[model samples]
Target: MSTRGNPWAVYRRLLSYARPHLGVYLLGVLGMMLYAATEAGLAGLVKFFARGTFLKHDPTVLWLIPVAVVGLFLLRGLGDFTSNYFPGWVGRRVIKQLRQEVFSHYLRLPTSFLDGQQSGHLLSKLTYNTEMVSAAATNASVSLIRDSLSVIVLLVYLFYLNWRLAFFCIAAAPPIGWLMQVANRSFRRYSTRIQNSMGDITRVAKEAIDAHRLIKIFNAEEHQSERFERVNEANRASNMKLVFASALSNPVVQLITSFALAGVLYVSERQVFAHRLPIDVFFGFFAAAMMVPPHLRRLVNISGPLQQGIAAGESVFEILDQAPENRGGGLPIERARGEIEFRNVCFDYAGGKGPVLQDLSFRVQAGETVAIVGRSGSGKTTLASLLPRFYDVSGGAVLLDGHDVREYRLEDLRAQVSLVSQEVVLFNDTIRNNIAFNAAGKTDAEILEAARAANVIEFVAQQPLGLASPLADRGQNLSGGQRQRISIARALLKDSPVLILDEATAALDNESERRVQQELALLMRGRTTLVIAHRLSTVENADRIIVLDRGRIVETGTHQQLLAADGLYAALHGMQFNA
Candidate 1:
């Protein structure tokens, strides 16, 4: 599956990314031309020096030769510098653009696109694949164009100088051709394996690092090491195969050049003995002939990096070519009144055997608190996710303020709604930053107020740094309850009109839950809220209680009314209350 696409198709795809950097890339090529002229000029200098002191070497020409040499060297160095620098600069720029585009695409991609994709694989595509494209396209292309032109110009000069001798040089090309073809085939074969192995290596590293605690808790350090060793060994073997194949190129080219040098020496010597060629001309031809084969060899060598660049470029282009999720949309709404209605909504989650939410209908009026209770796999989380349009409903519609969520600008819709789930993700930063994740522009006073509302400020204040106290990655420095509270505080700061709490208090102890729930009530005041609760007691005071069975709404009423009705909600209440 690694090298499935047509090579030509991949090339065409990669060329599209180069369009924007074409000017700088072309300038880089021009620099290479200047550099090529320097090498060619040095050959011309050899012929000049071969001329005798009397008539062939005039004082003026001799004086100008050193100056020309110096000028050529300076120009060549400048050209080489720009050629290397600009392409590298362009490559890094392209990488930045590619990373941003790929990440943004991943974010907007439909859940179905991302369901089975591994984080490490995606990371490899972003980092490894992107770098490869830059190296192959920018660096490799510049080298090919420059050296290739040098070869062409040098060959034309050689043929002009002596046609018979040039034929001998051209004769050496067959063996060189065979060698390059062999190397090319070998490299292409091993390179694909190497690339695939790289992806596997990255995946293992990401998984092992992410689950470090789990590995430690299970006393499976040796097991993790074994798994990593297997992946690393596979990667190492693939790399060695590529290196072995790559190692053949230089030796093969060098061998071909050796034979061609012998031919040039033999022909040039005969010409010198027969008095048909001057000593200077013979030496000039000899030197130029030596230069051509190596240049040709290098031109052949460029293909390896070119091939790799193309492969990596194709992967990056694939991501960049992906269409954004909501390209067409209406104007943003200035404000929303928190009226939400799910009108016959239906949705199928990624890789689901069937629809998770089917023909579901419900509504939450302004300033109403609704609690949705359901068994596991009953679409409780799926239903809540649709409100924010994280995954669009497949059928029917989800409306906010009487407009389809899809019709509203995504940012506008999201701004009106805030969610705090059981799984809290915190950045590796200060506690203040975690609380202010959603509202980064909030003042310290605003942050403190939000933390107090979520019942985290009192605890935060005890820390010497208060809001500035640093939190480790994923907030490992804080307890699970503290992390959840920080997330809740973030949601509170948003102060949106619509709030969705999915087991927000699930991880907290009774004391913490009580305090946070008290803050949650104040946060929920004069807002529309949908709470997904496993503990029936927590949502007993909700204005309405809805019991979901499978994908459908089985019953709807106030908690007291449903409890008295002895329905699904009553049964769940009894089960949890007893447990």
Candidate 2:
């Protein structure tokens, strides 16, 4: 859905975050009430001052006025503290809770959802949009409540001083309210557009940063700059629309209030001069009427942030409402024997972009090693992905240990498999932690043993920090071989019954590949392994190799048998050797 959701509903839902801290929120409301009363009381004091000095002629009135002024301001300061501190406290809490929930939900969302979203846009919602929500929930909300109450109290005081004049002063209310309604609609529309444009800006900037190497190599600086400028300009233009509305609203409301004030002053003067109104009452009504303008101005100004916040809330709630990844059935497995079968499987990505795999059937008995060889786009990776249920088959079923993979709990199913892909993902963390990632109850000795098996200890031991050394982001601090070995170490630590290696040695040089292959051989021992390889040499020792063309497996047999048959496998091996 678009971010321009119903403002009232968005705001109401946003307020619900404060429900857990209602006691503090109510205390803030009480503080605002106390502050509002003091403002009205200050207006009333004007009448008392006039009467005590000019009418009553009492000497003690001088001391009473100064003392009361001090007392009033002192109480007002306390009220201000309570109102600012408590609501701000609740607002910060709301921001934290909302941020946490959105981030956690992101982790559970389907792979399809993640693939369709730009990471930058998600980050913007987490950081920038959430800040906007807090501004509306706290600052705008508090100003709205406090200033509105102040306006009401001041109007009541004016009515008490002179009912007829007060009635004339509020005659412009309906028209001003109507004008504010128009401004609010404009505010919300522009605010939604501004937020979306901000996301675009973030998306472009992040892409440029992440792909800096590509842009530089391709001499595309000007291209990236142009793209950034487009989104940046759009963001600025959207903000200007909100600015124009907000700027115009305040002046118009002020003009309307001025007209009402002029009428009040004209009527009050004539009444007092004609001896129909008391002098003190006339002054008190004037003081109370004057207080309304500042409060009105605040109420007008707050609408911009309030509406922007509502728009932000709409964006945040959209993600929160999304269906999470399907976690499959109730059956759970601590471990599986890892006999895997793909039964007449067919698969397609979203939008029905034709089948990537069709009528593909294969099985690997427990503790067997099978290599899948194919040209690019031959569905090799897609077939392996099915084992972990990254994308379910469009038809047919995948089974693990004679049980449909769909009938096993997603977590339990994934726990039985380890994947090592060409792109090794390592967090910016210590080598030890990366190897032991979330593998609960693994002793340091076990961790070290896995590192040794994966050949990670050889390089790690040469460093002063050993396994404690921290890697840079995506393991940029290490060579491709080192990163690959660290990934293998992770898989070794997992020690699952099944493993899938998709060009795991593709990036390494020959020497490093040889070293890593030795470790991979150890990792594959006695485990059901599916290896997707482009290099024929890498899979020559497999018990069997399946040759795929397009989405179909054209041949399956031992390497020598496939070569003797002179089919697709022989053609692939010939091409690799010729290259």
TM-scores across all candidates?
A: 0.90, 0.97
Q: Which candidate is the best by lDDT?
A: 2
- For model 2, the local distance difference test gives 0.90
Query: In candidate 1, what are the lDDT values of residues 214-289, reduced to their tens digit?
Result: 9989998899889889988998997787677666677777877788778878877877788888877776676676
Lowest-lDDT window of 10 residues in candidate 1? 1-10
How high is the CA lDDT of each candidate model? 0.80, 0.90
Prediction RMSDs, each to the true structure = 3.2, 1.7
Residue-wise lDDT of candidate 2 within 1-579, one digit each (tens)? 333456777777888888999999999999999999999889888888887888789898889999999999998998888888899999999999999999999999988678888888999999999999999989898999999999999988887778999998789788888987887788888888988888888899989987888999999999999999999999999999888888888899899998898898888889988999987787777778888988888888888898888889999999998989899998999989989998999999887579999998989999999999999989999898889988888898999998899999999999999999999998888999999999879999999999998989988988899999998766877999999999999999999999999999988898998988998999999799999899888899998899888899899999999999999999989998998
Clash totals in order: 0, 0
- Model 2 ranges with Cα > 4 A deviation: 1-4
- Residue pair clashes in candidate 1: none
